[model samples]
Target: MAAQGQAAAGSASESGGSPAASAAAAAAAAFPATSLYVGDLHESVQDAQLFDVFSQVGGVVSVRVCRDINSRKSLGYAYVNYNNTSDAARALELLNFTPINGKPIRIMYSNRDPSSRKSGAGNIFIKNLDKSIDNKALYDTFCAFGNILSCKIATDPSGESRGYGFVQFEMDESAQSAIDKLNGMLINDKKVYVGPFVRKQDRENVSNNIKFSNVYVKNLSDTVTDDELKEMFGKYGTITSAVVMRDSDGNSRCFGFVNFENADAAAQAVQELNGKIFNDKELYVGRAQKKSEREMELKEKFEKNIQEVAEKFQNTNLYLKNLDDNIDDEKLREIFAEYGNITSCKVMRDSYGVSRGSGFVSFKSAEDANRALTEMNGKMVGSKPLYVALAQRKDDRKAKLQVNIFLHGSWIYTTCAFMLFHNSECLVFACMVGEKSGEFY
Candidate 1:
């Protein structure tokens, strides 16, 4: 019963089953007949019920109502393979709209479309996910268009489910086809929105700019990846690298930056992707600058503030204080020079040129000087701690805390006794009063 030898090369594409009504419409148009996969059959319907209703005007070879692989419950869809093209044509024409068991019967040819036919137009997106839908499901759903290297469904901690996911196919044609056909299709009653996956900026950055050599893109769909981005942008330029950033927790951020090997290529990518719609979102694109540049730029703003303060304190003349006896102004300036411009550093010395244990560090800007003061104050250099408090007048501090007391005759007692004890480095102070020689002495 094998048609192997009799079957020509094109015969496989041409089903041996006859058209139930007519193949003129399909064959004339050169359109291959695809099976009208039926679903939601009433539970008690049988093969006879289906055949009687469908085979009235068409060639009939076999009607196969597939059931669960193990449990064998009616899967609701039946495969009707007709013997002659005419018979198959008749069945579809006659019964596609016929009602059986309160559900209209649809009769189309059966086919298992391989990866070659993803070019048709449709769209796909998935939802109502139980969080268990895995990468294989994602790939299998879209891979029919072409080769798919990998796929993934986002999951939660404790490995639960994130209710979302991404799929990557080797061919853009396949991805496009999936987007077109499945975008609004109802699978499990959930209307899925399918489109190209956009990756996070960070992952894309790592792939192209940080870890790889290419343009980075942000505001990507969480599902976008290295390969897909390459394919999407590959037309624009020779992409040296591509990546979609993933959170440490393993989820894609919404956007990513793309770095092209040359500015020209990156410009091309931005031009092509900007305002372009993928997965229903307009893509954001640009060159990714290194993260450290922002820090340096912001820190420079404070430099002026430091110099302003320093000018008021020293009038541009270095007044060094608290200089370590062993270290001099030359050493002090050298240490602070890395912060910014240093006009001068001169340690104060007494008449004998002895170190005053205090020194001045003069930065060109009050900003830098104050930064040093704030950051370096109280910082210990070797065994000694450096004090960076405002340079106050020496005499002002000495005059602030003076106290005065006047003793009068009424303030004195006749006699007084006091006792103190010391034990193992512990000091104790105590007082007692007693009449010593005269009244209350």
Candidate 2:
């Protein structure tokens, strides 16, 4: 695997010896020489189906549908191995975008070294594209330049094109030629912008230099009027407009906006007035952002806080099921008290105050939680054995359940299909035997 090669190489470099370097070199040499990575496969496509489709062009030595180990559900990608490099190349040429299970599969040579991809050596970004363009159309448009490693169009959740895309070529010359010829060309009646791809962090750093003319201010004294707000900020900037936000009842909301005549003036006002006391309250000032931008910022902050909390309690929380009907919060606490310091324990109940036969327990330390889990799991309490494990977030539990259901359904469908085929074969054999023996009525 790529990870193994990287680890081995790192070890070799750290040890400064030929043995480790030779081992790393051997590992890199032995990996996936004739293997093709097949991506964008449908979840239901398995190894057998891939082999049947790919074997027409070459001798397939192996096919593997990558899957999640826990649920055994397809991960939407696979690997196909051929006996020789020529066969592998043929398969890649003939079946790059072959449709299976109503979805197209993308094929590429399996590259164990990830540096070429990560370095963004020959990647280009295309924007302002027509919404009609997709992956295949983009590929067709650019393939004349050189060998493309990958091409993709950004799309929304509903699968609508987002008017932008990325393409990475195998060689920098190809990428440069494409950009030079097509950077401002009209495609589908839209003039597109094509350039070398810039990473998100770099783009963000560049955006920090952009100018703005509108400023937001909060923590104003309730009695401050629009004129007073203007007077307070007029010292640093030429105010084009100033307004104190008011409620339906016409009372000040203690926040307002100021639009300066120039971006530099607004920036200066913000720099000087922010965090300064204005009418006994510390003023907060910043560039005014659109509602969507504010919402996105808040959402990111909320998710970060949630992740921190989850990490803080990661190994110290336990979920319990098959609880006895007689168990209550106090009894749950009593059961886990011997393991370690019990922070919180609760047995869930319905509105009618009846036991739900499930509970949660929190410990002050991971060791205590692990000890409790080892001792209590599958242990008989009253009429059933308890199920205990580390608690998962609601979203994670839901996703696991969905994967399990999908796998179970696929298994049932496959079993039924095999049964039907077997029955038809048996009927044909019985009819032939009867005809040959002259026993048919």
Candidate 3:
């Protein structure tokens, strides 16, 4: 936003600067075909006020005040177009810091070539590096990237590396090159991350070692030995070293590692073996990421997917079918009062939220959910048969999921069985996977 300014031509009180002529001139230029960009106006400020303020500096092209599309609220920033560079320059000089209704306006030269701006800061965050990796190592790793000006490694009180660091390549282009080649690259079994230098430790763990490079093999024929493993892989490259991890029994740990003389061979080996059938066991191979990284990724994905599914049916609402037609929320409450606290329940209706045909009952705990699903899953109540799995209203089923279904029933079997056993003592012996003991009818 830096600019060079020239002095204004004459005083405003000059006879030629009569208020009538100036306002008319400003109004006339307000609708020029092109070249206006006005910015930094108050939300309540109208387009006319902006035109009046900017037109005084130079001829206006078009004035547009931005507003939210849905809410119709002012976005606080607006654009004004001028017919040419001269007027824009004059406006920038004249209005850059002038306050309008107590709010300062920031005027700048509109970028004619906006594409020149960077899309994103390239990846350069250090990741998966050993906590032992010091600032020196971080500098060493990225210096070759380019003429690094300033590199920073975040450390703790002891000065031990916090497993991540940052390197500024002294220039933006060099930083970009490092991003292109090194992002998602493995460093000590981790990937180097790159981005604008922000102080967030959480971003460092993002897929640091996701580029697969190791293999998981099980059901290894007892005959397969470490040496045999090496011999098999030796054809690929000058072997780095192959070690068969062994159990306490000292048997071939059933898995081994083969470092290649070159990365290409290792890459090919990984590609060929990932999910390829070998020696009867499906050979799994890919970039070998660390265990904690894999766990974190899986955990996140599990939680996300579970939440999506749970949202399909509102996990919050519970439905109770087969209720006694005469039974209402109060009557049902008395029957199940001993279970636990109830959030809220009403027999659903068409428009009144009344009971449609069968009503819903909710319990606060999984124990309650289990008790409801189990006690009501197949129980014949009154004249209707009660059925309960989870009751999601039709409208709710189509909405975004708010509840987490995966975490909802950690021990579904036990919760369910509790309900069945509580119903009767006949020991009719009905078996379900989650229940330890069968229910007796």
Candidate 4:
């Protein structure tokens, strides 16, 4: 909401000299036919005050200040019915800023049915209100800026204020003026938040658009509670809710969700807390992804992993045995560089920091590797002959291992029954096909 200055001419009737005449002049420009909406009255200023004030202009018919059904307290606004249309018009002109019990009230033409009014025409939403501040208190607090049409404080089933309300002014300028002066102002030691009133559906759509503000956290300590989680993430911004998941036994499931007031706070919490240790275990925090999204991402990663492994076997990679214990990755690359553009080279190392006496060298092309294998096979390196051959894939290595196991009688079986009895585990079932038929390759 924004503020606007009231025109000086509008307040000329408040100066007192022949107020009724000045009101009649102002009414010519903006006047109602019969009823006037009076707002900003103190909780004690009842229908009597409204009737007494408007009666000064002309004949008065009825005055009703809306109130709670159970408590029967003033809702801070009322409707005044005047006998003559011109009398109602003059009431708005002169009584626009008339004081009632030390508070200046706003008066405007009555548009009683909200359904007939334009949506959000001059409305503002107010929240963080003190629980004790009823409709009258809210109205009296905001009435001085401009004429108000209707003011309402949301209440619960028990007729208690829900700490929020709505204020609608006759003119947008007046609504803006009130917001500018009263928004964030302290009332009853609590600062209230004021903003433009949006329709519920529009608010829901906006919330959906920024739903990333809610974060999912896992690996929480068993002792962690909702309040603790809120305190941890509240530094970033206001938190809407925080909950730690639990089991049937009331034990922590090691997971939780934290919803912030805005996306920026959620993003910050994710960046700073993801993978950070919490209660002796690393916690995972991130935007809560749907189950379908997680499954799709895992599938893509699996496909990518298979592609990478396949790429290793397709390149000009060569396996070498009898690699010197002292040969490191850089030395192996240097030795193979003369054999036509080596793409990569690495000597396998054991846990004790010694080479496994084997290494792999990948060249830019298969032709280069074939030539290098021909030239380097049986060549002396560190007093031992180098054994050069095409590198075998992980699956191919498994196939060879199965052949060696079958030859050594480790997988001996006379019939399919015996194989099934032993529950034989084969890494490459296809490679064993030829072995069972007396053919070994």
Q: lDDT per prediction?
A: 0.50, 0.70, 0.52, 0.67
Question: CA shift at 67, candidate 1, in angstroms?
Answer: 0.9
**Which stretches of candidate 1 lie above 4 Å from their native place?**
1-24, 28-44, 117-441
- Model 4, stretches more than 4 Å misplaced? 1-31, 36-81, 89-108, 112-118, 211-441
Superposing every Cα of model 2 onto the true structure, what RMSD results? Answer: 22.4
lDDT of 2 by residue, 287-372 (tens): 88765455445445444544344455566778899999998988888888988898888787889999899988888866678779
Candidate with maximal lDDT: 2
| Candidate 2 Cα outliers beyond 4 Å, as residue runs | 1-33, 112-119, 128-132, 156-163, 188-191, 211-215, 222-282, 288-441
* Candidate 2 vs 3: which has more lDDT: 2
Order the candidate numbers by lDDT, best to worst. 2, 4, 3, 1
How does each model score on TM-score?
A: 0.26, 0.48, 0.35, 0.33
Question: Relative to the unseen true structure, what is the Cα RMSD of model 4?
Answer: 34.0
Give lDDT tens digits, candidate 4, residues 1-441: 222232332342364544334433444345445877787666577788778878988999999999979857677788898897777766765676667876667666677576746588789999998888866566556555455566778864224577899987666886786666667777677778887888888888885565478788877888999999999889989899999877679888767888988988898888898889877988878787654444444444444444344344443667889987888889888877887987778787779878899988878765577668877989988778999976643433421321122223311221111110001122221212222111112
**Predicted structure 3: lDDT:** 0.52
Estimate the lDDT of model 1.
0.50
- Model 3 per-residue lDDT tens digits across residues 1-441: 110110111122144643323322332344222344444455567888998988887778778788879856667677788766557645654565467865556543343543322232332566666665655445445544444333456654223456777664434676776665566666555555655654344446553323333444444565677887778667766776776667678876455566666767777777666676657766545544454444445445544554444333234345666566577778776765665666666665557655566665556654455445655577666676767755532433332323221222212221111111111111122223231011111
